[model samples]
Target: MSRFPTTPDLDRLFRPRSVAIAGASTNVDSPGHDYVQAIKNMGFAGPIYPLNRSADEVAGLKAYAALTDAPGEVDLVISCLPAGAVLDLVDQCGKKGVRFLHLFTGRFSETGDDEAADLERQIAASAAAKGVRILGPNGMGLYHPGGGLSFRPDLPVAAGTVAFLSQSGNNAVEVITRGNARGMKFGKVANYGNGLDVTPGEMLRYLADDTETTVIGAYVEGVPDGRGFYEGLAAAAAKKPVIIHKAGRTQAGARSAASHTAALAGTAELWSTVLKQAGAHEARNQEQLLDLMLGADMLPSSGGRNIAIVGGGGGRSVQSADAAEENGFTVVPLPDDVRRRVREKAPGLADWVGNPVDQSILAGSGLSSNGLLELMLESAAYDLAIANVGEDWFFGRPDASDRLKHACNRLAQICETSAKPVAVVLGATETNNREHRAIVDEVRDDFAARGIPVYPSVERAAFALGRLAGG
Candidate 1:
């Protein structure tokens, strides 16, 4: 009943059988060269027709002078041509029966020029009349590794199930690069810059039913159709976890967004209310967005707010407790059974340590922070947990690397085996010591490789867990 195509039909747009890059060029620095090289690098298993008016070959592929000159049918057409030339390109795509036309071309509407805005309107009208869906008039288009499609050649080639829809191309690139570094694998990603013919709402509706996508994250400056965006967001959020970062909250930011993407940005209060009512988690910035996405995809669903905190020294333990409680998680006290086990292991310090088992006090005892974590998770007192690696303490100790690795290995195993969700916290590698940095990086990478949710700080870990647990 919706205007947007369901998953089956949307697949054709994403996984196009054949692609054509209009304005394909020989210069490697330009986007024209990047599209051709990107799809080729992604190993797109389809005919790639590079449409160029003059060049005989672009990116080592035979180039056509026009869309009509291509031998095979073109399913997706990526336009890098000038703004003035887009109308003709759209007509060519319509005549060729092209289902999608991604305009990497800009300078229309967002330029704040009356003539440019008029041109954008005409372009929209023409595309609709010709039955051609335009992804963006000022956007970097799709990036679906599974479909062998990428806008930039430098993007990661590994396919994943975390789908993201961003209004800013640079933001999308940052999310992909940073999220991938933090073990967030992405599936379908689109930068619907101005949301001209194909709005973010329609994309949301499509991703809602997409079997390949398990979690969804979106970065939006504004929407042309507010009602449609709301409906689409509510529908998607009803099915799976959705994280939305709405930028352009301030007046200046709203103006910038308008000039940046021709978007009518909304106020912070209005967007916050809408996101909450729509059943989607609201992220304030890129960091929060990535953290929420990581939590949603990697951690299991937890219904209770009771949390068990472990690791770190006295100061970090206090900090962790404050963070957990501030994020709406109850730093539940260790139950009698856990205390009984602690007494059995180390009777002298059983009462000294509380919910957050201070690693400093348990130094000589046979019990490790990981051991306490295992015992606490086994009890019915807690529903989730946060484990701090306290790498700084290990750095000062004898044989730091070996001890750190051994502890981290045990902690990772505990996280992997635990029925309740445990978010690991390893401080950001900020020390000047080169060896220490490597050890920290190595351990964090290991955790990521094992598909464990690891955060740089306890506060971030608590915030992510709290949000995911509906706190």
Candidate 2:
């Protein structure tokens, strides 16, 4: 019934027994240095060799003059050398029987240099002859925390259910960092730039059946093989929900994508149709991409498009309704039974409260927002629920700490057994006030630890939920 019953095994390429860093340097500021730092810091066992002719030691690893001189079999090679030097290095990699070569070096076809294009072709030819897998000629390589792998030292080392493949290295870093703030953990990520050999489609096919991956997110600026990617997307969607951000929609944007990754960005309208057909959610930007990544895995598959909004004032409620409806969700009013339950339980606010249950009305009314949240969960009238933190109002009060803690803890507890996808809306990341930021961060951490998905705003939460709701 499904296209891909099994996916490719990329273990040796990722979980190498021995890894060599080509062009590895002791320069703390360089990408070469970051690679070595990440490897050693992650406690990656086995032989770790740094191949650099000029350096005596690179990030504390014993420096080898070259790959040929390195002791033992080199399973993986991460090249951080200049693009001009990669062709010669590719031949050396083949000679040394290296199974994989990950290139952090750029200046290839993306540069639009004729000489650079020829060098990229040579890399492909050399790798093919030796049966060596090339990750990228201009890429950030791999980021798998469980395997003690990463291109940058700052990324999260704790792995989780989400796995992502990004064509742009910077976008990869942004997605990982931003997703981390929202309590997102990742299983694997790859910044496969200028994809000379290891195409985005292949990574998709691999992740489609990856046991560690339950949810998948992808950011692509371009791809050479449209049919291959579509097939991969369809197959992956059959096994798990796949969310994608297809960049380079505009003519100017396509030119930019080409220059950045040497990608052939297809038409936007066509991409929209293709993604919908493939059962993939098309993320307009990287932020929404993170939302899909978290919601797709954390929320259940049966989440309906009908959303019941609670919390926020008149303006926020209107905004939430608009956001939900705009994203293809129905923001329904409080059903008759739920209203009845609220009336009996807390009769004072029955007349004032409605959909988007304005928290301001319930003050000193003996009714709690948590109680309303629970009532929504119990009622069959609502398919999904949104709980707004109303952080700005809470923090403005002198008794901010007690009020914030009580509300967050209560909502966190209620969401523990929620059958429906109950989303909590909190304020955005605070930068100016350290004290306020810490308080919000603590609340977010609590919700994350308890396995509840939290969003910065109702709009974002609604958009994320809408995508998961099959919009």
Candidate 3:
């Protein structure tokens, strides 16, 4: 029924029974040694063959002179040899019945030399002829956890539904580590540098029906196969939420991308239009990309723009209102019915309450700040709500720390029942204020555990919500 492989394959590339690190070595700083150690660090429960002609061992693993000399069958080979030498390695792999060869070797077409480009082409042709798929003439290869493989040691150990395919090796690590801190767990992530083999479009096709992947995030420097990308992205986005961060958006950025990965950074305008046509959200920066995924993953879509602000004093309320309106949200006044309900709860204080319900004004009143929020949560006047987890203010009061946690629990419970999007704004990632920072950190974790997305600032919260709503 589906065109893509229902079962993961190029199977050995992911779940290799035996992986031969072709150029694996004992050098502390070398990538050759890093691959072996990285995999071992990830706790891969498989036989590892270190293929080195000269070295007796690599990273303290048993060394074989070649793939053919290994004690047993080899499912995958990671080639860290010179570019010119990859052709010979491919031939050996074909003879050994190796299913996949990861060409970690670079200095091919990326150097912009005609001879190097020709050599890359020859290797690709040879691999294809022998029924072997090449990962890269220049790439970081795969990082699939379920199958027990990883290229870098720092990647998250816990597997998740987020799948990321990045063209920049270092950027892939950055996104993965930073996103992991924000509770963005991952499923399958690959850094397909120079994309000589296993292009972005092909990865998309396979990921489209990948049940393990609920969300797909990608960082592409270029798209040489525009038509293929269009088709694959459209198909995948049809099944799951797709967020793309197209890096090369300017003249300077284009030049950097081209030199960095030998990519042809297409015009920003055309890329933007293409993303819209394919129904993919285009993120301008890494933070924005992270914001959008959180919106897609955590918030429910009501498709309505009305918002009721619930926390922050008059100053914070005004600032939040500006941000919400700037991001296409209608900060409507509290409706009469909701006000009447509030009046019943706190007869004396309801007269002073409005949309924002300044916490200071309601302090001495019989009504709690959360009671006003409960009224706003149900009001039809607002399609969604923003509750500021005022953690900074809660400090120094009697039993205030525990109250903050309880307040967050209440907001999380309200969100669970509300069909509408309810974004919470917590403050300060600035590290100088460790006390405030520590409090915010624990509260953010509390919110995260309760399945609430917290933003550092009101503007960021509003901006992310706006993009998720497509306004």
Candidate 4:
């Protein structure tokens, strides 16, 4: 038999028709309360049985004393009980024929207590014997909006095709919240803390075959099984774009991860090699991970490294050139045909402007940056393009809001009609000017609503585009 050959049925787990929350409470502050409230808030289309020993009701639903008491077939049981109470919970789950048991309870092996570690081992053994798949002993569990599931009540309700797996619950929340702002609508998400029974490997294998998941992103502290993880990762990456952000690189970081999830961290170099060999992209940090996933999910595939950048000022052009070249992209010079087209509209810029298309020099020219972007993408000289919004420049002009909105609308139209991918660069809302910040935010929201990928900097846009282009 293969070691880790069998993967869990994640479809049933992710899309459970009936769910029960053990240790459900009425206290509005606790995780127990959060789970119950979150499910109710998500408009779960199934029966929600809250298993509470004392409370008669939890978050407006009648509470059962135990999982066995829940009057119907329960597909998934979320345990918010203490670690000491988990062994009994597992037995109850088995007796009830529960398909999945997600333990939001912590203080297990990650606490570095011998008794706790032993208890965790026993829980895993019992769960396996009962044929009930475990999601976490100290994790936040699932957040699939499409299936009416969420770990938190405040999360966005939009359903998408992007799937993400993380070891830390907070990290998972950050990625979902932040990625959503970047126009990344997430489909399935799991934060399997400690990764006791259903490891990242198993999740990857499941997601590899998942029809709903178009792109996969992972935030890993460590893996319980290395070879299995690699195989699963390789399988998934071969099918769709997979971006892995492996944390716990340094010794201190590893030690922290060990405490955080009882995970045994590996060397950064080794992890990098493994990720590359598995045909997956490696992200150094959370920011890079989000950027890569966003690019892979939002932009169409591009096999060429030739980049056409149009927007920003002369300084931005220089920085963009440096960023593009540094990231292994060729900032190709403007083709003669493109230059002649520019000369017809603006004779002065045809000679002065090079590849980056300095918007400053074309101030008086009837052509806008969006116009230049359309023209550049038309030529065979470029494979992909980047258009910089340069909101700071707009802030200095008359009627910044109207002008910015007009430019962005044109850019959005261009992106919609263009055959090649165009990544837009809009500065972060870092300005002290309130009006400027609001205008920038509105523009970003507009772009996001139109499904245009916007990066905070030209360098990030370049990096994401370059990596996606296989540079």
lDDT of each: 0.91, 0.84, 0.81, 0.91
Better of 3 and 4 by lDDT: 4
Q: lDDT of candidate 3?
A: 0.81
lDDT for 453 (candidate 4): 93
TM-score of 1: 0.98
State the TM-score for model 2. Answer: 0.94
What is candidate 2's lDDT per residue for 147-244, written digit by digit as tens? 88888887777878788899998899999888876778887888889888777777788888788889899999988777778878888888998999
RMSD of each: 1.4, 2.4, 2.9, 1.2
169-211 per-residue lDDT for model 4 (tens digits)? 9999999999999899999999999999888988898888889
* Residue 128 lDDT in candidate 3: 88
lDDT of 3 by residue, 394-429 (tens): 765677667877887787788777888888888875
Error of 2 at 102 (Å): 0.8
Candidate 1, 177-265: lDDT as tens digits = 99998888899999989889888898888888999999999999999888878878988999999999999999999999999999999
Candidate 3 regions with alpha-carbon error over 4 angstroms: 1-12, 54-60, 395-403, 416-419
Per-model TM against the reference: 0.98, 0.94, 0.91, 0.98
Clashing pairs in 4: none
**Which ranges of candidate 2 are over 4 A from the true structure?**
1-6, 54-56, 429-437
